[model samples]
Target: MAALIDAIDVKRKTTFELEGVPYYCLDADISSPTARGGQTLVRLRMRNMLTRAVFDKTFKASDKFKEPDLQTIPATYLYSDGDGSYFLDQESFETLQLGEAMVDDALELMVEGLAIQIDLFNGNPIGLTLPAQVELAVRSTEPGVKGDTASGGVTKAAVMETGLEIRVPFFIKEGERLKVTTETREFAGRA
Candidate 1:
């Protein structure tokens, strides 16, 4: 028997199968029962684990759902080739390649030797989970003019080692390490 999940726990990043299709919940808008004992329901926004298409759904009461056969594996980032980025599974010692389209915005955070969690469905790579924040070195940025603090600490465009560009304080410069939030691709602070 498969593990089951309560409807309320079905939020962002939660995986389950609906009508035999695997999906990851992106968000849920839950409406509680009214004073008159109105029906409670939860509206869900979810994505297809395979096709990456998004859809909306609604669940009532404590709808129990069978958890999909999804597995999380530790992998090491290798390098991006013409087709996609390469990774090595730490446990199985096998290499896997995820297509560029599959990685999406994660390409901005990927670096050689970075540890990541890969989501696998039926033994196939489906998605990735990166560290909440990562330290990446600034590859290049325009030099800040002296006394530029007068601009109320204006931000300038800087490129990271992985080629992701972000607005950073002028005081930052080339060859500096910056802590960046992977989810938003925003600069958190100096590393």
Candidate 2:
């Protein structure tokens, strides 16, 4: 049997089940009552594991939730086809094909052989979690002018091998490897 967690204990990344559906906590905020002996409230921004829907709701601090049966397994990007994207589970060596809606924006950051974690509910793959940063090879960019820096904070558009376009320093050029933040899709630094 899974354990029950109080609403007041919910935090970012917490996973719990409500009414037989699993939800992941994206953010949580607690409000203290202004008056004495008043009810405390916990507001949470939650995402549905099955439908990917997100919403915010408030619950009493005493509310309880059952921990869902969830697990994250290491996987490697295998390839993509007309059907969907494929991944190889490191532990069981099984191939998983996720639908377009499931892969979504994460596909733009993926490269062949990239290591990532896949969330599994019960026994089925549910979500993809990318690393905070990823190294990608620059596919193309314009040449940097010698005095480009004179203007200060000069940046140029660059395309990565995976077709993700992002702004990079003027000095960045084709074939160079660069670190990029997955959340913001911004250039971090040279790989």
RMSD of each: 2.7, 1.9
User: Which pairs in model 1 have colliding backbones?
Assistant: none
Query: Candidate 2 has which clashing residue pairs, if any?
Result: none
User: Please, what are the lDDT tens digits per residue for candidate 1 over residues 8-57?
Assistant: 77888788888776888999888898679687788889999888999898
Q: Supply candidate 1's per-residue lDDT for 59.
A: 93
lDDT of 2 by residue, 1-191 (tens): 89999999999998899988899999999999999999999999999998999999999999999999999999999999999999999999999988888898888899999999998889888889999999999999999999999898999999999999999999998999999999999999999
Question: Evaluated with TM-score, which candidate comes out highest?
Answer: 2
In TM-score terms, candidate 2 sits at: 0.91
TM-score for each predicted model, relative to the true structure? 0.84, 0.91
- Evaluate model 1: give its TM-score: 0.84
Of the candidates shown, which would achieve the greatest lDDT relative to the real structure?
Answer: 2
Prediction 1 global C-alpha lDDT: 0.89
